[model samples]
Target: MKTQKAIYQSSLPSNTRNKLVLRRTRKRFNPKIFINRTIETTAIVSLLFTGFTGAGAMGCWGMEIAMSSRNWQHQKNICLGMMLVSFSGFLGSALIGASFSIQRDKF
Candidate 1:
């Protein structure tokens, strides 16, 4: 039907996707092969890690809020742990950004 055809069309790969490409390493698992690219990858991974950790922290915070009604110390501890993890992830991301900033500069 028309709706099915529309869905199929929408599912097709985007033709206007980002044209920029990440530089590849000369050798697999070899950071020296592409020092700049290695830093780029590290920064990207750090960002992803921070995002996941932040999400976890948010969930823990929600749980803590729910348990606040019951005055449960366990939930507070769990939330604290998650917040630490999130903070660590954010710190890691910041470190990676500071270390690899030169990689993002134009030649």
Candidate 2:
């Protein structure tokens, strides 16, 4: 009973505990610094490419929705098709984003 009480007392509030863990963990595993400018530039370019492509996909989806909403008969089919396309874009964006993260060693 006394040992259990001690353990309970040692446990911190959830927020403070999480912050402490994060701070300590970050300090332990610091990221590597790239020596070449082109490495950084390439990472930035990759990020931009992925971001813009994903955004463009979403924009096209938006246009489809807007165009489709005008009619009742075609709207349902168009919206369903757009929704499927958006879901695919979401998955593709996730994969592309992961590739960028892998290259940057951010994940």
Model 2 stretches with alpha carbons more than 4 Å out: 1-73
Error of 1 at 90 (Å): 8.0
Q: Which model scores highest in lDDT?
A: 1
**Residues 19-42, candidate 1, lDDT per residue (tens digit)?**
433333343355544765655576
The TM-score measured for candidate 1 stands at: 0.40
Cα lDDT for residue 15, candidate 1: 75
> Which residue pairs collide, candidate 2?
none
TM, every model = 0.40, 0.30
For model 1, the local distance difference test gives 0.56
User: Which window of ten consecutive residues has the lowest lDDT sum in model 2?
Assistant: 1-10
The number of residue pairs in model 1 that clash at the backbone is: 0
Displacement of residue 94 (Cα, Å) in model 2 is: 1.1
What lDDT score belongs to each candidate, Candidate 1 first? 0.56, 0.52
What's the C-alpha lDDT at position 101 in model 2?
A: 65
